[model samples]
Target chain A: MSGILHIAGLGPGDDALVTPEVTEALAQATDVIGYIPYVARVAPRDGLTLHPSDNRVELDRATHALQLAQAGARVVVVSSGDPGVFAMASAVFEAVEREPAFESVDIRVLPGITAMLAAAARLGAPLGHDFCAINLSDNLKPWAMVEHRLRMAARADFAMAFYNPRSKSRPHQFAEALDILRAECGPDRLITFARAVTTPEEAFNTVTLGEATPEMADMRTVVIVGNSATRRVGRYVYTPRSAV
Target chain B: MSGILHIAGLGPGDDALVTPEVTEALAQATDVIGYIPYVARVAPRDGLTLHPSDNRVELDRATHALQLAQAGARVVVVSSGDPGVFAMASAVFEAVEREPAFESVDIRVLPGITAMLAAAARLGAPLGHDFCAINLSDNLKPWAMVEHRLRMAARADFAMAFYNPRSKSRPHQFAEALDILRAECGPDRLITFARAVTTPEEAFNTVTLGEATPEMADMRTVVIVGNSATRRVGRYVYTPRSAV
Candidate 1:
């Protein structure tokens, strides 16, 4: 029996961007496994088993995919955006190490459109230069570490793409985080709000740090805070021509 | 006759990654115009009028594309990798402003796989977060500006993607740039080199700043300097986990 593990990228939002490679991988898979929402993006088909669960339960899904792969089934572990960027790739690797049975399994991760690229494309290239991505979600890590990195990026004048900026349970966290960035970088910095990027309901708004104030963002929004060089041109916001 | 300008993305290196969207646009184009090399990437198709020119002559190509659009020809302005990132999109806008006759023409810039993303995918996720792209070619800019931004990115610990890092005549420039980064970001800062990524002769190598000298890179190489938080795992290098 032959077993291969394919990690597919579901793109940022729209299904149209799902590459031919991803669609081909999905078609050949005996088991399609991913975070619940990611799994739902593909159509249900015959001879395919769907394994869906919460995003936090990555280890469980990896183990399940490993088990399926080891059973001589072509298993595909899917993730929204790119599989390698904070997605199923690491968990799959971790599972491979823990389970010697899957050590030699053929694994390849197909690149997808990451949310950072999607958000940047919508905001007129706020990511034109050096930047950093930081997740404000404290569910798995400490807020102190996140804060330290944010401050460092601000001081370095790196543009920032903030993920998990806010959720209902932690609604005020983004505002507090904005305050911290404003204190370190100054209030004149540019903040861009990209909501439902690449989706039909896409909306964009750019403002100063003083105007951002948490109210402009939501859980679904990707917040991009421009560095010192970022500027407004007509309706679009972008980093000005680099002196370099 | 509706005049249309299609800015098509020729994916990084390999022609297969050229999405169906790009192929479709190319098929419909009557005038295929862009930089000489980019124009050469497409096969000699019947009924396609080709307009190719020098690298520094971007405005010239955009001007010609706009003229073709004004003449009611279906024009496809080509750019290697993505149209938006340091490519034809900006030039198209510039041409639109310079010649008001083409202002009413509908323009579309279809996204292509950027070299940064292609290189990142091949060398793990150095750009897994916010990052900046800086062109090291000093044809239109001064070296002082490049050094300043490099110093800032190094000090602030931003992941950096470098374009035109080195060439035959100006080979020592990339070395000097690396020296500044090494001084500010330590000799052990992780650096990933991607040459002709997604092409038949694709090459990937990861080394520390101490190991990266000017000789290691050339015009075709896209260099990535991982931030302070980037770490090495065996042969792969990656930034801190990005969650969105």
Candidate 2:
């Protein structure tokens, strides 16, 4: 039996944000597979098999799901935020490519509100016009690539939201990134430091890249750096293309 | 009875993207109001009133809604994308500012996906990390400020999305913006041109910014120029800082 793979997007920690389709898929899935933290977000449902694993082994989990699907299990591969946005969707595709028999497999990717958009919304739409998203983790790609993007983004003057800016092992990366940005842009570009946005523990801050050092962020943080068009109107940050 | 004010975010054209809450609110609203096109999207329910006007006359509509609310009629302020992003929410706030008596009125902003996020999702995670959105419409703001932002975003090398890039009369503005960006960044930067994204008529072309001329984009387009880190892997455009 060829099992259909449904990659579900669990919107930024809010059950209300989950679409009816995603909810229905979760309710019907024989096996729910995801990273441990993401798996914990789903409440218990009867007859559902939960396959949770650590974050370190992503491909392994995808392979396991494919194997289970090949065994005729109705499987749902879940990811926090959109599954296609740097998540399980890629892994599933990679695994599918490795096995030709999976060619006939029906794969559906249901989109979700990514953290960048969620953070941008909470921060008053600094992302209202042009923007880009860059992960600061240098685990897979070289930091050189990250720096190059940073330089290009700075030169391009796009409003930016950074994910995985800082982690335990790489504590000072955000600071370094800020330094590069400040040099390329200027000191006064409005920047927002948003953590756990839309979640109950959501916290937000406004600063300049000049003020944003590594000490101010972590893995939980999504940094928003405004373009030169961004301005400080009272306490709020807005990028006005038209004068009010 | 003080009439309720409904501020609706019509998600990026996909009817399925409309949340259950939005549908319920739209159904319940006695008077539906918005820019002409947005008002046309939701079909008239039984006993519903429709108020459609030009896109730029937001404050006027908000004022009208307030007057209707004062007259004990429920009114909705509808926008094609999220109400907050360069849309009706601010106008509602502005109208409230004009008539402080309406300050205590009940207001609800239903969240919908914005065009930027929808476009980014279609373009393959160019928005997965950090980014900015900027409008090229300069009716309210001077070209100097817009130029400043364009220069700054280029310098910062952030992923950038441009909105309201051009119209019939203002044909050359986006081209001028492109010229500015080209001079600041290089011709080799990856650019994704998305028009009518997520809609049935969605059209898209992804190429290097060097390849994108102003004629290729218009007011209907949402343009994304990738940071140096952005790469096209197969059909996907992704910028990664790590593998996992």
TM-score of each: 0.85, 0.76
Task: Compute the DockQ of candidate 1.
Answer: 0.29
Q: Candidate 1: which stretches are off by over 4 Å? A: A94-103, A122-126, A129-132, A144-159, A180-190, A226-244, B94-103, B129-132, B155-159, B185-187, B227-244
Candidate 2 displacement at residue A25 in angstroms: 4.7
Alpha-carbon lDDT, every model: 0.74, 0.73
Clashes in candidate 1: how many? 12
Candidate 1 docking band:
acceptable
RMSD (Å) of each candidate, 1 decimal: 3.5, 4.8
| Reference interface contacts recovered per candidate | 0.15, 0.29
- How big is the positional error of residue A34 in model 2, measured in Å on the Cα after superposition? 2.4
lDDT of 2 by residue, A1-244 (tens): 7776677778777676666667878888899899998888878778889999998687788788878878888888889877756677666666655675665666666666677666665554465444667778887766776787788776656667777789998877767788889898988888888888778889888877667667778777888887667765333345543343
- Candidate 1 lDDT tens digits, A24-108: 8898988999888888887888999898888688878888887888778988888887776656776666666556666667666
> What's the C-alpha lDDT at position A61 in model 1?
88
